[model samples]
Target: MIAWRAGAAYPPAGPFVPVAGGRLATLQAGPERNARGTVVLIHGASANAADPMEGVGRLLAARGFRVIAFDRPGHGWSDRLGAATPAAQADRIAEALGSLDPGPVIVLGHSWGGAAALALALDHPERVSGLVLVAPVALPFPQRVALPWYWRLAAQPPVAWLLSRTLGPPLALYYLRGASAQAFRPQPPSEGYLERARVPLAVRPGALLSNVEDLIGLPAALERQSPRYGSLSVPVLIVSGDADPLVRIEAQAEPLAKRIPGARLLRLPGLGHMVPWVAGDRLAEAVADFLPEAASTR
Candidate 1:
């Protein structure tokens, strides 16, 4: 296998936190004591922590809040701990947070990262003071969406191993622009986001396999976990674009806002899945509403 270093593209914006799986890579900003609560950012499939949250992280940092972003297991500079379920990843992150000692935090999760953030709150409510979910897939759809035929093929060990080593990187590279455009329909991404975010890191042999397994396992995991959302004690803010081409607003954000007793939902008009890039500081401004001190200032 090829060894992938962290700083080549994305840069090491924070220290690596040692964990059971591997040294978890993180990007952090702000030590502004006058700021609001600490913020933890978790990114989704095919992305490292800095991918979706970079702009927002900077904005929050400028506002004086400590912002921390982690490259989840098996992606970016982080090593593959195992094939982890959301809850399992949550446990590992909890330990990582213990090492940081940032105190109770505001957690922001995008897409698949949203599930793990929810799991963190479910398993350890005292650790999360508030939550922000952007274009999340937090609820179990009444019916399972169909997976591609290739997903079935990859489910098998022999086929998966062959594909990961042979065709994965090429395929991911070939489809990069098209997929990003589709996901961001109605709004374009910032120029060169793919290169800036180091999209190639995700398509590396082992990362590809882990992402596939995570996608395949999501339905079952949400089936087991969706019921626990209402039991979470933290205040929540769920944001989605009405035009998001990836996760359905009705299927995820709307229903989740209703399900979680007091969770606030914001449906952005004419926006798409890449809201962090497309909307930028506006999203950060809305996120500030979740923190008590930030909200008071707002």
Candidate 2:
């Protein structure tokens, strides 16, 4: 894997923990002195845990809850484990949380990370207090991603090593800018978002492969998970942008809200996929309202 300089540019928000045969990077905050509950932030694909959740984590931390953000496997400083399976990724996170012992947690997952959040909630409902899935890719739509020829070859382990050695770096570098633009669509990134988020690192060979697997393998994962959504009894807040190009709200979010009984839906009129950057404060407020009252001493 061609590790990006940004991996060394700055460390993940917190230390790394050994879990699931790899190091999982975690960023944590909140005053444990009188914490109500834990809020676990799971970031989307191509972006690490820190960049996307930075603003919102501070907001939630100030609300008297412990906030923990994780670099999803193979993204940021976290070692690449079996990230292709959202279930495995969820298990890795659960193992990490077990080490922390924060008690039941409110999970906030964005985009691809939403799938992980859902899997965690599904498999371990006792551990998850509530869910705030933003622009989540939880439902399998009819049309799935059209994997690039390079991605097809990259997903294969035999040629993947060779492909990563030769073409992965350059391709990731080239596509990242356009990818960011698409993610923030109908509006550009907020000031310093590109650099602050370490956008270049998505080009790193490992991260790119993981990203491709996430895109290519998502439909089946969603298909497998969607049927069980009704069984999840946790309070859920489904937030999405009406103008989001990446995960269509009409196709994914609306139906998802219906699947989870009494799941609350919040729609931003024209925001794009990057809700934290586009409307962090508003989203935070909405989340605070949706969450079950956080006890003063959890």
List all candidate RMSDs to the true structure. 2.8, 2.4
RMSD of 1: 2.8
TM-scores for every predicted model = 0.92, 0.92
Q: In model 1, which regions exceed 4 Å deviation?
A: 1-13, 32-34, 142-144, 293-298
**Model 2 misses residue 11 by how many Å?**
3.1
Model 1: per-residue Cα lDDT over 19-38, one tens digit each? 88577888888874666778
Model 2 superposed RMSD (Cα) = 2.4
Number of backbone-clashing residue pairs for each candidate, in the order shown: 0, 0
lDDT of 1 at 139: 79
Q: What is the C-alpha local distance difference test score of candidate 1?
A: 0.80
Regions of candidate 2 where Cα sits further than 4 Å from its true position: 1-4, 143-150, 293-298
Model 2: which ten-residue window has the lowest total lDDT? Answer: 289-298
Error of 2 at 82 (Å): 2.4
